[model samples]
Target chain A: MNAVADITQSRITRRFAKLKAEKRPGFVAFVTANDPNPETFREIFHGLPQAGADVIEVGMPFSDPMADGPSIQASSQRSLKFNTSLKDVLAAVRDFRKLDQDTPIVLMGYYNPIYVMGPAKFAEQAAAAGADGVIVVDLPPEEAEELDVHLRANRLHFIFLTAPTSSDERLPAIIARASGFLYYVAVAGITGTKSAEEFAVKDAVARLRRHTSLPIAVGFGIRTPDAARTIAHHCEAAVVGSAIVDVIAQGLNQEGQPAPGLSQKVLGFAKSLADAVHAAQH
Target chain B: MSKVEPRNSFRQGVDENGHFGLFGGRYVAETLMPLILELDKAYEAAKADPKFQAELTDLHKHYAGRPSPLYFAARLTAHHGGAKIYLKREELNHTGSHKINNVLGQIMLALRMGKPRVIAETGAGQHGVATATACARFGLKCIVYMGAKDIERQKPNVFRMRLLGAEVRSVDKGTGTLKDAMNEAMRDWVANVDDTYYCIGTAAGPHPYPTMVRDFQKIIGEETRVQILEAEGRLPDTIVAAVGGGSNAIGIFHPFLDDASVKIYGVEAAGRGMNSTAHAASISGGSPGVLHGNRTYLLQDENGQITDAHSISAGLDYPGIGPEHAWLHQQGRVTYVPITDDEALASFHLCSKLEGILPALECAHALAYVDKIAPTLPKDHIIVLNLSGRGDKDVFTVAEAMGEKL
Candidate 1:
C-alpha cells in the first residue's frame, strides 16, 4: 500500500477486498501481545500470517479484561506479569513490520491502557508503528469518541464489535463510522465459550449485512476447525482468539510458565482454522 | 459562610451526554449501549412523573425507613472538644445500611422497564442484603454476585441474603473481590440483557447508573440539610462519607454541590498505608483510567491492569470511585482523603465506645477522617458524617483483629 493514495486504506480493508476478489472467506488469528514475553509474542506475530491468518489481533493486556473468559484473562495476566505496557505492545508491532508488512495487525484490549497513553498519541503511534486497526472491547460506538476521532484521523480502522444482544436501533450508529470490517460476536457471554449454532449465525450475519457493506467477521466462539468453517460459510472471515490463547495456556506448565514450543502449538491451531476456512470458501 | 456560587445546582455538571468533565461516559461493550440508553430514557420518564416520585417516597418513608435520623453526636463532640459532630444515621435503615436506598429505587426502575430479574454485585454483602430485601418485597428474582474472598470474610451476610431469598453467586476471579464481582455481574448482564436488570451497588459504572444512584441517594444530603437546620439552624461546616464506589459520599455530596461553604470529603480506603501497594486511594495516588465501564481514576499498575484494592473494610475495598467524585475532586469542590486500616479500625472502636454506635468499617473511614479534622476546627464548626452501615456483621472480624477468638 502506497502512502499517497492507499494510506487511508488499512491492511484490514485490503484483506477484505482481496478475500472478495478471491471469492473466499478470510481467516483471522488472535494471540495476546507479549503474553509470556517479547520473544514469545514475536513467534506468534510472524507465524500467524504464514499459518494462514488474514488479519492478526494482538491483545493489549489489561488487568481487568471484563469481557474475556478465563483463558484470555490468564493470558493477559501472563503478559502483565512482565509489565507489558501499551508501549511494548506497539513496539512488538513495530518489530513485526521489519520482517513482513502485508498482514493486518489489530491491537485489541480494554480502554484503560490506551486512555492512560492518551488517545491521540496512541493513534499516532499505532499508525507510525505500522498497526492496522484497534478493537477496544469496552468502547461502544456512543463513547468511542475518546479513540475513534484520533484513530480515524490517523487513517486507522476503528473496528467495532456487535453482539446478538445489540438492538436494531443500535446498528446504524455502530456501522455508520466503522471502516475495515465489523466483528460479529457469536456468543452473548465472554469469549472461549461454546460456538454459536449455525442457523443463529446465519440470521445474525444477515441482520448485520442490512446495515453496512463492510465485510462482517464472525468471532468469540468457533474454537475448532469445523465451527470456524461453519461460521466462515456465511461471513467474510472468522476470528478465533481464546482457542489460540488456550493452546498457549495448555502449552504452559504448572507455576504459570510457558512450556517450550508454545508458538508452534498456536501455529498448528491456526493452520487447522485456515484450512477449514479455505475448504468452506469453495 | 462566604463563597456562595449562585445559579449553581447539582445538575450544573455532567453535560448532556453523561460526562463529568471527561470522566463519566458509557465506556461499555456495544451490546450494553442500547440497554443503557433504554434505562436512561426510562429513568428520565420515571424521574419526571409525580406518580413515580410519590410511590418512591411512600416506600422510602414506610418500607425502607427514610429520614434515618440526623443525630447530634454529643459524646464524640465532647471527646473531640472542637467541632459539633452529627451522624446521618443510614445505619438505622431497614437493611442496616445506605445501600437499601439505591436498591429500592433501582428495583423500581427495573420493574418499570419490565425486567423479570435483578442482578447486583456486592463486596460487604450489605448491598446484597438490601437488594434481596427489595426484590423479596417486590417479588422479583434477585441474583447477587459476591466475591469468594468477601463471602469468606462476610459469612453472616451471605446467610442473611440467602435467608432473605436471594441467590448469591460466589465469584472467584481476579483477587475475588469487588472488582472481579462487578466484572462477573457485567458479564451476566451482557448475556441476559433481555430479561435481567443489573442493579449496580454503587454510583460508579457507566452513565445513567452513577447519575441515577446519586439521585436516589441524594435523600441523605437533602434530609441532612433540613434536619440540621432544625437542630443547628444552618448547613454543617463540612460533610464526610467514605468513598467505596463513591455512592454514599456522592449521595450526601450531590445536594450540597452548589453550597460552596459546605466542605465535602470522600474518604477512600488507604489499606495499610497510602505509600504501600495495598491501598484503595484512586485519585490520591492512582491516575485516571477506565474500568467497570466509566472513565475514572483507578488503582492500576504500570501496565494498566487494575490492581487489587486493599482495605480492612470490604465495603471500601474497591479500586475505583464514582466518576462524578473524580470530577468533583478535580474541580476542587470536594476533598478526597485516604484512611488506613489501623486508622479506620481505631475509629470503629472509638465510635462504638463514644456514641454506643457500631459503624461499618467503611463509614469508620469517614468517621476516622472526621476524628482527624474535627479536633482542629472550632466548636462552632459542625461536621456531618455518614454512618453508612452498622458493624454487626463485622463483629467476628473485629474480635479476631483484637487477638480474641470469635
Candidate 2:
C-alpha cells in the first residue's frame, strides 16, 4: 500500500506531530458549520481553539447524515433551516482561519457535495478556504481513488474513518490512501448512540497500531470527560463530536433559536474534554 | 461492421471490485464491509451449489408461481395499431407483483447464511409485502423500513406487511422516501450485523446486490426470452420495463443483452415533467453519484444533497436508479426514457380498459412508453413489456388522483 497523501506539510499532520512531541493526545472538537446560525456558529467556531481544542472538526451539514445519531442530525437540520450551503461552510472555515491559523479544521460530511462541486474544484476551494482536511463519511477507500486524485493534486489531506468492522484484510487499502491521521470510529453504530467500552477501544487502537504510522484519533460515543480521557489514553487524539454538539443543541431556546450563552455553553463543554485529554497524558 | 466489439457476457461485467464501468461500487460505511464480503462469498458458494439452484427452482415453481404468463395482448396490440404487443404478466405472480421473485431468492440466501432475521427497505410496499410473505414462509423475523409518506400513501400494503408478521418501521427523515428508508435499513444492518440480512429490493446497492438481485431477477428476462419464442416462434423485437431501482428492467434486459436485434427500453418515472424539478427520472435527469451504497445516477443538487423525487407510484419514487441501469444507459445497449404522471395514469386506465388487466403505476410507465412507440413500429414487430406489478395496491392512489375517495 502506497501513501496517497503526503501529509507531512499539512496543518493536520503538524498538529498531530506537535501532540506527539508534547506526549499528549489532542482534543478535537466537532460542531456543525453554520449550526443554528452563522452568528452563533461564529462564536462557537472562534472560541473553540482558545477553549482548549487542539484541532477542530466542522461537519458539513448534510440532509442525510446516516453515520450520525439524533443530536448531530438535529443540529444539521437546524443549520439547514437557514439554508446553509457548501459556500457558507467554506466561508465559515475562512472566517475561522482569520482568528486561528494553528488549529486544523477538518470539514467532515458525506461525499455527495464534493462530488457535486467536482472533486478537484472542491479540493481547491476547501484548501483555499483554509480547510485542513476532508472526511467523506460514505466514501470508502475503494471509491476514494477518484477524490484522492484531486486531494493529492491540491495537497489537501483526505482522511479515512476506520471502524471496528474494518478488517485486517481491508486495512491495507484504507491505510494506503489515508493521510494526516486515521479517524477510529469508537462504536459500530451511529455517533452519540452509546459510549464505547474502554477495553474494546484499547484493543481496537492496539490492532490499528500494527497497520499504519499515521496518528489515530478516536471518535463516536465519547460523551463524557472520562470517556474522552479513556480514548486519549489509547489514541493520539480524542474527537468529541456529538457530545459537544449536544451541549449546543441543549443551549438553544424553544423557538429553535440559539440562546445568548450558546457559544460559552459549547466551549465550556469543549474545555472539559480538552482538560481530560490533556490530563490523560501524564 | 461497427468498430466497437461486443462483450462475451453481461454477467461477467461487474468486476470483483463491484464496479460496472465506473458505475457500481461499494460506497457504504466500513461496518458493513465484512458482512457485504461475507454475503458475496456466501452467494458465490450458493450459486455454485446445484442443491441451492434446485431449491430456488422448486420454490419459484410451486410457491411464487414462475413462468408467469407471457400473454399476447390482442386488444392492446390492436389499440396500439402497429407492433404486436405482448405483456410479461409478472403481476399475476404470488403477492401480485414481480417483487416476490427477488425476495424468495434473497430469503433463501439469508436462511442458508444462518441469519435469524431479515431487514429490507420498501418504497411502494410491494417489496415489503413480498419480503414479509417470504419471511413468514421461512419463519424468520422480518423488519422493513418504509418512508413515513409511503406508509401513508401505501397503507394497504403496510397493513399486509404487518399482517404477515413483519415489523414495518417508518423513517421520517429527509423526504421520508425510499432513499431515507434505505439509509435507515443500512443503519439497522450496520448496528445488527451478525443476526440480520439486508434483502435489498432491487438491482442496486454494493456489489453482490446489483449482481445478486439481478441474478434473482434475471429469471424474468430468461423466462421472457423462452416464453416469447414459444408464443411467436421468434424473439421479441423490443423489451420494455419500468426502471426504479431497476430490478425488473435489468432482470428482463440482462438475458437479452447479446441479442443485438432486441432493442431494450427502460422507462423511468417523470412525475410532472423532466424540465421541472419534480420527477423520479434519475437516469434521464440525474448525474452519476454515490447513493444507497452504490455509485449511480442520482437526483442530487450541486452540493450532492439528494433531492426529493416525486411520483404517483411510490415504487418509482426514488432519487437514484440502479447502477447497472446507469451503465446500460451509458453503453447505449438500453434506451431509458421518462413518462410523466398523467401519461402513466392514462396508460394505467388504458391497460385496464383495453386488456382487462390493471397495471401498477410503475409498470404503467412502461405501458405508457409502449403506447408512445408501439403505434409507429412495423405490424410484424413484437414488443414485450414487463407488467411488473398489479394495480391492486395503487387503487387508492389512483382514486385520489381522480378526485375520488377510496
Clashes of each: 1, 2
Query: Measured against the native two-chain assembly using Cα atoms, what DockQ does each of the candidate structures obtain, in the order listed?
Result: 0.74, 0.72
lDDT scores of the candidates, listed in order: 0.89, 0.89
Q: What local lDDT does model 2 show for residue A28?
A: 90
Off by over 4 Å in 1: A1-4, B1-10
> Candidate 1: which docking quality band?
medium
Chain A, model 2: TM: 0.96
TM-score of 1: 0.96
Candidate 2 lDDT by residue in tens digits, B134-219: 99999999999999999999999999999999999999988898988998888888888779999999899888899999989989
lDDT of 2 by residue, A35-54 (tens): 87889889989998889999
Model 1: per-residue lDDT, tens digit, B99-174?
9999989999999999989999999999999999999999999999999999998999999999989999999888
Least well predicted 10-residue stretch by lDDT in candidate 1 chain B: B2-11
